[model samples]
Target chain A: MKTTRRTTILLALVLLALPLAAFAASPSDAGTRWLHVRVVDRSDDGESVRVNLPLDLIASILPEIDIEPHIKDGRVTLAPEQGVQLGDLRAVWAQLRQAADGEYVRVEAGDGNVVVRKAGTLLEIDVQDGPEGAEKVRVRAPLAVLDALFSAPEGEIDLAAAITALAEAGIEDLVQVEDGESSVRIWIDDRPEAP
Target chain B: MPRPRVTLAAVLVATLLLTAGGVVVLAAAEVWRAGTFVLSVRDEGPNGARVAVVVPGIVATLAAVAIPFMLPDEAAARIRPAAPAMRALASELAGLPDAVYVAVEAPGERVLIASRGGVLVIEVDDGPDHVRLAIPLHAARRVLRSVAFAAQRTR
Candidate 1:
């Protein structure tokens, strides 16, 4: 009788835990994945524009792309359909390649791809798999106001110049720029207020 | 006290198996994809509980694909053309702004929040049978309820 009772109790406990275990095992087990993609650029004449590029980029660049919203491992993951061409990503990478220095900035370009990372620079650019194996590059800002420094042909991409242009456009909003080993961050004056 | 009699071990094992089965089923069926949410709903018949995963597509294709799996051979014969109905419904829901806190419904027939309009038409395939909701956005949800309802709803 005691053994039967114990077995019953065990079974009940297992039943109660079934859903909880599944929930815990789910990627959300850690937390929900919230992705925010911010794109800031100047239009030829230099009117500072910053907009959320997550959905828009998906629609415009990869029409057939799929976006899975989930939390995987410990970090939030936005697994976009194979390849999505993010304009800001391309622009940042182009700038990084031009600013590559022998020691600080390292450039590895092969297999129709390019990667640039500068030790002291305010940004770290990651170029990886995208839709249909296309290059999906991500430029991370390590500092609150980190800027990418690059030297492009005559009128191409210039990091310092872009910074100057941003400042001139109304960066009393920009506070500080932090450079990381992997990414760069830019802090704006209205940051604490503006996200 | 009136207490329930159930075993914890049995419960856990059963739950694990059920969850694993669900995961496997979903993966195998390729029901997992972008812009789609999986949901479990009960049937409204004497048959009691039933699981039906809903998807968006043209009505005819939906009827064709769902009839064989959701209903028996006899009932599928009664199903008729649903493409015209789905197209009308899809066209109405296509271009609404992404504003939260709105309720769109048709009295007792249906009450739902406006989710984004995708390429395919919304469908409800009750196992072995499919039924297309002919009501469009304008007719389903009254303007006042659609625009003023402050409750949150996910499409």
Candidate 2:
């Protein structure tokens, strides 16, 4: 009778533990999945705008700002913690101000790409992938347009400082700044991975 | 001569009533649900919009009430064949009390399956080469999460 009771208890324990085990195993057992996003400039004008980024990279970076991200079927979904919206925006703006030293403009992200455009009345911004792997950013807007937008009282807008701040925020790496007569373009290449 | 103010007021009121009646008749012919979201689609143009609203649970209950009365006869016939399959699918989704309600629309014959939680998955009938997606409740939650994020960011 003791042995029968012991066997029944063991069976019940095993049944109880089964669900817990399954729950723990699901996420990792799903294996490695890749999410790719591509953006094309479908405008008639020769406005060169192209961006590519992996969704997993964004998912990993979201936690720094206290956002829980979930990716399913190539869509990156994020749920911000309650009351973190305004706080996050303020913190982000403050960080940008400090980094730019009053040379900050507008930053936008859409279709899985972060775009920093010429801060002008007209909408002019360069589209590029977020800092992950070897990605490149090409800004086709002219310097005059950008300069006109950046009407600073004291000094000119420092692109290097702005780019560095963006990189630190896990946005992108500014590799080379190309200056042209018509357009001053900056190429943001992905930073080399650490071993 | 005295101004015909009373006659004008009567004419205006009659016109307004006729317009309201016409709108009601047209609305009855279409599929509309006021739940966590408001979804209204016209049968003629197949043009529709879904907008999220506050008090989704109450809205969903109200939608449940209005669905039967509003569903046109043609839509009712089209929905009959897909009803069983939709019920089975809704039952498969956890946390849903009732089987998914199927609403059909003419002009290419579209099918909208809505759960008790105001989650809708639409299917379009395109001859033999057709595709239908059954989005789970979790997927709907994910969508809502994204919208919430957007709202936060905008704020």
Candidate 3:
């Protein structure tokens, strides 16, 4: 009787603690995150494609794949062909990070207009080009992700850290592009698939 | 066939009526339960092509059960990684309030994507063609969940 009672009590405690432990681990918006990329091509042959990848898998595999001199050691090194200097990028990023949350750059030209600003937790960028500025592109990412990109030394971008930030932030619609043909959206969430 | 039994014929008639009544009741119940599913589409077009689709919530939920069997091994493996994200998207959309997620108006074309009262709607009007789709967010989530489930079983 004692053994049976003891076993029953232990089982009950375990059952009770399971939910509490789970809640504590992921109280609200915290858990394994999945990155989602959706493209809807609405042209002559309309097609919708969805790609979902877990941040953990991406973080693990990114270092394994090498793209010559440009990407190595889970970090991205700029090539001479790219023309943009790492020092300039780092300087701009540092300035943007410290600056107050507001529109920093706004250019309205005859061809197009570009807007780049820091809003809340996101670095928002919008670019309009083409005829009458019809083609539009928007990119939004958490500050943490940007910080991770510059985490490495010698002006190399640390992709692993950036992925970790993307996983933790649970961001949605990190990048969106709209044109006459189709619209593309990429986001990160806790879900593995898209509907 | 042995005696041309009247009882058998009577039973057949009674069974048909009972089944028919049961189907009607179930359909009504489904319509009522389809809160996240059914929504009116206020779309304007020159052609005025209208279509009514009564997709029960259960149908979307049931797709989860069918995923494993319907998907091939290779496809299921590919989908396994994305199942969780599908569930997350579904959950977020289901809870989101009325808002326009995307709206683009171009020459001779207009596209609107919005969520209203837990229902996700997509509308596109191009030239004389107009298409609108409204789905309860929960149903979409359920369908996505099934995809996740199928992905797991494949592994």
lDDT value, candidate 3, whole model: 0.70
TM-score of 2: 0.22
In model 1, the runs with Cα more than 4 Å from the true position are: A1-4, A16-195, B1-155
Interface RMSD of candidate number 2: 29.7
Over B1-155, each residue of candidate 2 has an lDDT whose tens digit, in order, gives: 22344444555565556556666754543233222433333223345333332344344444444555555666656554344333333333333322323343334444545443334454444333233443435334333333323323311
Better of 2 and 3 by DockQ: 3
Docking class of 1: incorrect
By TM-score: ranked, best first: 3, 1, 2
Tell me the lDDT of model 2 at B116.
Answer: 38
Q: Which predicted model would earn the best TM-score?
A: 3
Error of model 3, residue B83, in angstroms: 27
Error of 2 at B116 (Å): 24
TM-score of each: 0.23, 0.22, 0.47
Task: Give the candidate number with the greatest DockQ.
Answer: 1
How many angstroms is residue A55 displaced in model 1 relative to the true structure, after the best TM-score fit?
A: 10
Q: What is the Å distance of residue B24 in model 2 from its true position? A: 2.8
Residue-level lDDT tens digits of model 3 in A74-118: 788875467868878888899999999999999998889999989
Chain A superposition TM-score, candidate 2: 0.20
Task: Compute fnat per model.
Answer: 0.15, 0.00, 0.00
